[model samples]
Target: MFKQKYGTTALVAGASEGMGAAYAHALASRGMNLVLIARRKEELEATAADIATRYGVKVLPVVCDLAAPDATQQIIHVIGDTAIDFLVYNAALSFIGPYLSTGPSTHLDIAAVNVQTPLALLHYFGGKMVARRRGGIVMMASLAGFQGSGFLATYGASKAFDRVLAEGLWYEWKPFGVDVIACCAGATATPNYNNTHPRKGSFLEPKAQLPAQVVEECLQKIGTVPSFVSGTGNKLVSFLLSHVLPRKKTVKIMGDSMHKIYGSKWESN
Candidate 1:
């Protein structure tokens, strides 16, 4: 029952599935009207229907790819004339290959959605939240974003960008009564894993609370914590790497792992 102190309106991007859909439902359960965004119209519709039926809360589904060229403007258009109490930027993408193996354009595109889009989201609605003087904005980042991962070079880097920006915003917006948090999630059972290496220790089987639990916890915590790392293992790793490992060593280890996973793909690129 620990929702944001702000009024009851929550907007979640990437709500077609996984963490996004879960966040939508969590807010709905707390009596917040919902605005869900994602590229798949049918999937968004299905998610909206379930939340409406299960929680008896209003749900609005907008189909737009955050990675699209005009994603920010499109998202802004959808929020017109509506006040949002909470904003969860939960969209994500991953390209698995070494730095050279991946095309530069593809890597930059990852930045467009993962890094630029989040900043743009902040640029658009952030002021409204600050002016109203209430609300929360959560950025969905991964522990991998904490450091460079060789095969997932662009993805890891983008996450790095997200984490840094989230923390910076928390400080900048705190005076305005707006809270920002970056959730550093560990590996979860999401469809993004299909492109990954099977034997890599990176995979964490879905269990217990699942992605839904993480989403729910995030909503419940809002202003209580400015930054958080989900999952014990992931948090443990984050702590250890910061205290025990050197950056050079960590990057090398991750790079070697990427090489192992990508094989000749890294060399070809």
Candidate 2:
């Protein structure tokens, strides 16, 4: 029961892999043509070909880092003259480990990928959507966004900004029949886990969620809510963390764990 059923066209960032790939497939299954953006050109092309073959949706690939200055304009150009009714701004980068230990430039780059690009996408496409008065957007956020972290401070903080921004926009746009969803997904298995957490295993190998679970959720509920935490387990963790744990304690525990796992990777696991 997607509130905004896929009809005309859709734009998705980070559409080459993980949840973004799942989202592109779901939208294609709903009969929407897609313009997909990702840093990897070959991967984007491959995904487009697969989707085109299987779902028959016209898939356009825009290879971009998105953290670059020209990214917004480049995307706008690709979307020229297309009536985009759905936009999934799901591309994000997470650099785990201590904030102070990481280089300032690296943190800035993380901000560029996680916060800046999405902001640009919203500004560029949101204006057009509002003018048309018919579009829906999902800004892929994480449960990590809900609170501060010790090891993953920058990533969590940026996602916090994303979640709030999406919620604020959702309220302002829904009356215009536009839905801005802030999806807070928990630890669903994706390649990016290495970037987000201090782990050393494939997200697949039966540990975390398959990409399909997140995609399935996004497809079923397009615009009914401002936010949707992806899995029940994730939802529960967020709930407990929100209600049970004190801020200082949580930060301490997270920091210690990170120190054990990532900050000292040379040490035996």
| Displacement of the residue 168 alpha carbon in candidate 2, Å | 0.2
Model 1 regions lying over 4 Å from their true place: 1-4, 194-197, 202-209, 259-269
Candidate-wise lDDT, in order: 0.79, 0.79
| lDDT tens per residue, model 2, 21-96 | 9989888887888999999999999999999999987999999898897788888786687777789988887776
Clashing residue pairs, backbone N/CA/C < 3 A, model 2: none
User: Residue 41 error for model 2, in Å?
Assistant: 0.9
Query: What would the TM-score be for candidate 1 when compared with the true structure?
Result: 0.89
Residues forming the 10-long window of minimal summed lDDT in candidate 2: 198-207
RMSD in angstroms between candidate 1 and the native structure over all alpha carbons: 2.8
lDDT of 1 by residue, 11-43 (tens): 898888888887887788888999998989998
Q: What TM-score against the true fold does each predicted structure earn?
A: 0.89, 0.90
